[model samples]
Target: MAELIGPRLYSCCNCRNHVSFHDDIISKAFQGKNGRAFLFSHAMNVVTGPKEDRTLLTGLHTVADVYCGDCREVLGWKYERAYEPSQKYKEGKFILEKSKIVKENW
Candidate 1:
């Protein structure tokens, strides 16, 4: 993909306090309500508090929730394998591990 002109912030779905962006993309991450709205929703965090692993999310134990730095909104989540306690995944990382995006305002 071509490089975007601004910073980009990506969040995790399972854990509400976690958020990330390339050290190089911090500024562009704060675009607006349209681009950063998902960062503040439970749909992204999965649960407001601790959540027991569901059978459907099968094998997903460790959940990392994330949000935006500027508005402190929900952005996404990252799910870790129940068997493997590591960060590396074969198919690349899955950000926003379980949340759904209802709108694309941002």
Candidate 2:
């Protein structure tokens, strides 16, 4: 039988970009049209592109594409600014595409 793991870490599939640590995960397996993704309250070694207004999602005042720090591959997006203050917590958070990431042990 497969042992049950508490949780899994994720990295960019193409270049194995380590974005967040275990404690940084806000949510896992977020489903979308693209695919399942991991939501992190914090991420590291990510660069954001120019912020576009009212483009990606409604009420998302400013959003930008996030890239891997090493390979420059599109990994996820960073929400810089949002219309609601309550949503401001997600300003620096990331929604990394599962399809672009690989689950890692430890």
Candidate 3:
């Protein structure tokens, strides 16, 4: 099995917009309606979203599409609101595509 790890830095491949996240914050790999894949993160930075685009996603409330601050590339999204009590934990978190982000060391 893969051993549990700690925090690591990641960045946008197109513009180098970066964010740091603990391995624990990563939720799961999700496939969007547009057929795009994303890696969910409970914490992120150097992003600009959760303000411009909004839409209803699954059981969640209005989710915002996030972008890279430097290149305006659609990096991921933030779960702005949650409609269900169980989903409330996902609010304020981010969802970035693994393809869009590259590990600083790897």
Could you say which candidate leads in TM-score? 2
Over 1-106, each residue of candidate 3 has an lDDT whose tens digit, in order, gives 9876544767787866565454634555565545444545554555555454344455646677777777777766777777788877777777776677777644
How does model 3 score by TM-score? 0.67
TM-score of 1: 0.31
lDDT of each: 0.34, 0.74, 0.64
TM-score of each: 0.31, 0.74, 0.67
Q: Which is the better candidate, 2 or 3, if ranked by TM-score?
A: 2
lDDT of 1 at 103: 15
Candidate 1: tens digits of C-alpha lDDT, residues 28-87: 222222333222222222333233442222344554443444344454433433444442
- Backbone clashes under 3 angstroms, per model: 21, 0, 0
- Identify the candidate with maximal lDDT: 2
lDDT of 2 by residue, 21-94 (tens): 77777877564337777778887877888888754444555878888888988887877787887667767778
For every candidate, C-alpha RMSD to the true structure in Å: 10.9, 4.0, 4.9
